[model samples]
Target: SFSGPVTDHAASDDCGVAILGAEPDKFWHDHKGAKVNAIRTRTLISKADIIVVRFGEKYRQWNAAFDAGMASALNIPLIVMHLDEHQHALKEVDAAALATTRTPEQVVQILTYVIKGTLPV
Candidate 1:
């Protein structure tokens, strides 16, 4: 999650914001650490209002499924950014609940709009 105050559109002021990312330590660490990190990341995602996931060949693991599940269970918006040339199977995600793209800047813009209440669903 984002670790600082962000501009909240609801109040039109700065509010504590959290940008929830999934299983970072798992993706970068060994098996022993991945399990623990997955749990921690899931916990964070369950508590967040928005979840941003980078989808590509690099994240072909099942962690992405876990993140998607968390977002679905919470009924929060899930933003998937495709950064690579490889096509991914997005069938597990709910089309109505997900926002997908191929750029980091698009993700940032969407997040900013979400925080500012300017995004059109």
Candidate 2:
């Protein structure tokens, strides 16, 4: 499952509209059963060859650490995108091993290159 803070934009969607204003625990319990029964769900995680993480201002350190851990555990390539102001923390992870992008479009471009095996690395 893709876990992240729900944004206002998501709340306007059909599924989100239904879950709007519901308690967090209630939502979790409601979805738990179906989440367990899906076979393709496991494949979703394992089949991801690359994980692109967007690190904005709110949770920079936490998101970066989480992405790093997930990438390491799953053995998938990880690309971290952040503002130029936060470039210093990029060294906290593997500089040469991680792909960096400064914008959302750049993140996509980086992932495309990585998937195509053309990224410098």
Candidate 3:
């Protein structure tokens, strides 16, 4: 991995989004089932090779820690990037995260190198 060492399971087949696959932000909220999406998100989080939570200033209600907690709960690799001021007090759970970066490009580079064994030129 580009950022740091992670578990072997962090490079599994079930990853969060294959870079350009789908918009991870609002696909669930835009859909019909909130309850179903919660379950699905849980299942996905459980199996994901990595969990990335981008902290932006716009959405006050988006629970980044909840997702981070889920990732930490599953012992999954986590990458957090804070573009805003609110960093919560998750303590050791936050320390357990693989990396906390500022740029999405860094996250992408790390994931690409981890998954594809190459860096973007």
Per-candidate TM vs. native?
A: 0.59, 0.51, 0.59
Expressed as tens digits, the lDDT of each residue in 1-121 for candidate 2 is 2443334433322242264334357555445433432233345546666666667787446635665666657777767677887777666554634677788877756655755757544
CA lDDT of each prediction against the hidden true structure: 0.58, 0.56, 0.62
Q: Give the winner by TM-score: 2 or 3.
A: 3
Candidate closer to the true structure by lDDT (higher is better), 2 or 3: 3
Q: Which 10 consecutive positions of candidate 1 have the poorest summed lDDT?
A: 10-19
Which has the greatest lDDT? 3
Worst 10 residues of 3 by lDDT: 1-10
Candidate 3: segments with Cα more than 4 A from true spot:
1-34, 60-62, 87-93, 119-121
Off by over 4 Å in 2: 1-45, 94-97, 114-121
Better of 1 and 2 by lDDT: 1
Which candidate, 1 or 3, would have the higher lDDT against the true structure? 3
lDDT by residue (2-101, candidate 1, tens digit) is 6211123332111111123223453433443444455566677767878876664653336666666777778878887664453436645636346877
Error of 2 at 11 (Å): 9.6
